[model samples]
Target chain A: MELADEAIRLADLPAADRRTIMILGHEASGIPSEALDLLDRAVEIPMVGTGHSLNVAVAGSLVLYKLAGLL
Target chain B: MELADEAIRLADLPAADRRTIMILGHEASGIPSEALDLLDRAVEIPMVGTGHSLNVAVAGSLVLYKLAGLL
Candidate 1:
């Protein structure tokens, strides 16, 4: 289990079953360090525009696609 | 300029700049046939969960990723 950064621009690794994605909540400040430490690797979706992130369902779907190699 | 069905299990085509993705709104009805007719092709992200679709942004990201050959 390795702690990997999830910052999209910086994350060069591809998504796998062992990795996790942490999209921050609007009200929450950030991911808890303890939780982050537990993740094997952190993954992110590279995005653009004024929006921060997509709705959770869509994010999860893409992650699944990445893990399943559908895209 | 060919109208294509977006049903996940049925859609075998990949996303491209010429294609479009139409995620139904929570309260809205399906895409109007006229609009569908305008789209060269309709693409869908295949999912196995009870959820029907991902948020528009995430879906869009995945579509762009496919076209860009990121995945």
Candidate 2:
């Protein structure tokens, strides 16, 4: 939350662009919807694991990789 | 290292595309240059703090923000 907020605040992006933001994770349930509203989209990554979440950097990397068209 | 490697492997990206990858942080010294060679660039974010590094997620978020042209 702090990281997202800081990124938005520091970047000073328009709300519309922020709305285009998509945060992908397996544990989307833990994140607040209001915060999701702050982003453009919030997508849950499909995964099956007793360990239900990925490291945040790994998650971010995956999302960026796809978004950057490197995937 | 594990995150980068996994991302690269899972994405099955070309080596040239991987070379464009940049890992930004305050502690570039700890990251191996060979691994960096796998990336196109490695940039160090300038900061002054007793705290040696940003959280990995935060660092990733910042890098994504800039690379995505949000910053």
Candidate 3:
């Protein structure tokens, strides 16, 4: 719970209080700019590796687990 | 924390008391038989969808986060 002020961990989110929706972008180009206009917030998985990004399915799965309080 | 009695969740492991190692298998074939001979336990992610399995990298990443107590 002592994370940086801006870092909102998925595990710490109030999953029971509200419905959650996740939008995963294309691994290479990411979500189109227009789609970005409809989202309420952005959530990013913290990574420290050299890979440019995680596979889109993997990213989506992780978020789903976190939002579902399964992780 | 009231998971199935047979389930030993990564989050419930005593991470602070011991070192943890994770071995990821090939995406298609999975870990070799010889390699399986050495591991002490098998952990599986519960899934409900029609996909046969998760992307290997995603599976590995999820385990790492759980073991690291970051999930």
lDDT, each prediction: 0.51, 0.45, 0.61
The sequence of per-residue lDDT tens digits that candidate 3 reaches over residues A1-71 is 11223436655554434875666777666666676667665566666569877666666777776766566
Model 1 agreement with the true structure over A1-71: per-residue lDDT tens digits = 12235444312545465545544423234456777666555555555568765565665566566656455
Task: Name every residue pair that clashes in candidate 1.
Answer: none
User: What would the TM-scores of all predictions be?
Assistant: 0.52, 0.34, 0.61
Badly placed stretches (over 4 Å) of model 1 are A1-28, B1-29, B51-61, B64-71
Per-residue lDDT over B1-71 for candidate 1, one digit per residue giving the tens place of the 0 to 100 score = 11235444312545455544544323234467767666555565565568755555665666665555444
The better candidate by lDDT, 1 or 2, is 1
Per-candidate clashes, comma-separated: 0, 3, 0
Give each prediction's root-mean-square deviation over alpha carbons.
5.8, 10.9, 5.8
TM-score of 2: 0.34
lDDT of 2 at B60: 58
Clashing pairs in 3: none
**Fnat of each prediction?**
0.26, 0.30, 0.48
* lDDT score, candidate 1, position A62: 61
DockQ of each model vs. true complex: 0.28, 0.16, 0.47
Docking class of 2: incorrect
Candidate 3 lDDT score relative to the true structure = 0.61
- Candidate 2 chain B weakest lDDT stretch, 10 residues: B10-19
